[model samples]
Target: MREHYRDFLIRNWEKGDRTRAAAVISYVLSEYGLGWEPNDADRDVLQVEEFYLATGGEFWVIEHQSQIVGTGAYYPINRGEKAVEIRKMYLLPSVRGIGLGKYLLQQLEAAIANRGFQQIWIETASILVEAVKLYESHGYQPETGVETARCDRVYVKYLD
Candidate 1:
């Protein structure tokens, strides 16, 4: 990759990064036709930050070309079950086919593995065909079969 194309970096999200994070969420909401309002995206950004800061979850932002284009976080879902949930994986609309999503997924997998999380779970809308495909492409399989939180399909991945 050229120097400019090599500008992508994933780092811990800071409080000051809310605006950038919101931008990525908005892109996701829009691309998936989620109809999320600006306030909703902003609120989610705060929630993500709080999740990471409070429970020691990992929140990451992908900065490409000096802009936040992708994001994902992992948080404990069931300590007794030795599992963690991967949440809010998003890539901007414009950067969809450029391999950024794969990079983000790889980073999340590495982070979760390093943290000793035995299982990784993800819940995404059933209508989100692309997201579902992404998860399935990454070795995630359907673990749960009910619609929840406004009709979403939940999936799980086990790490070796």
Candidate 2:
């Protein structure tokens, strides 16, 4: 971790970022005792092109000191009309609580709105208390029908 959390850079994924980005996601999930399996819970991570970039969506990589430390992304989903689902929003333990998560989330929201998506949906596990609070604090209202195997909660927010 660097002293300047704000010094990191967020950019569209490159073909070479696949492994490092997936590792970042896996490390963060493991910190909470969660499991990640390629082509399953992490299928989109494995196929970033097919699941995201090729489908009118995006996946971003956050890097600090030349190392990838976090990831955030979204993709259009069938959950709601003109809606997109936020996925793979993970920050390493060392980078938590420095406002980076909030910044990254805002970036995601802006992209969604810029694309004319009417709303944003998020599915997460209750054990990830920080993420739960982040979404709730940002006005993502609680909802039903969490489709992820490890998630027990859902939140959705309509764009203005």
Best by lDDT: 2
State the lDDT of candidate 2 residue by residue for 31-101, as single tens digits: 89999879587999989999999999999989998899999999999987899999999999888889999
Give Cα distance to truth, residue 128, candidate 2, Å.
Answer: 0.5
1-160: candidate 1 lDDT, tens digit per residue: 1112256777888787787787777767776677655454235467765666578688887777677877888888763267887777887777777777777787788888888888888878877777888889989988765433543687788888
lDDT of 1 at 96: 78
Top model number, TM-score: 2
The positional error of residue 26 in candidate 2, measured at the CA in angstroms, is 0.7
Where does candidate 2 have its weakest 10-residue lDDT segment? 1-10
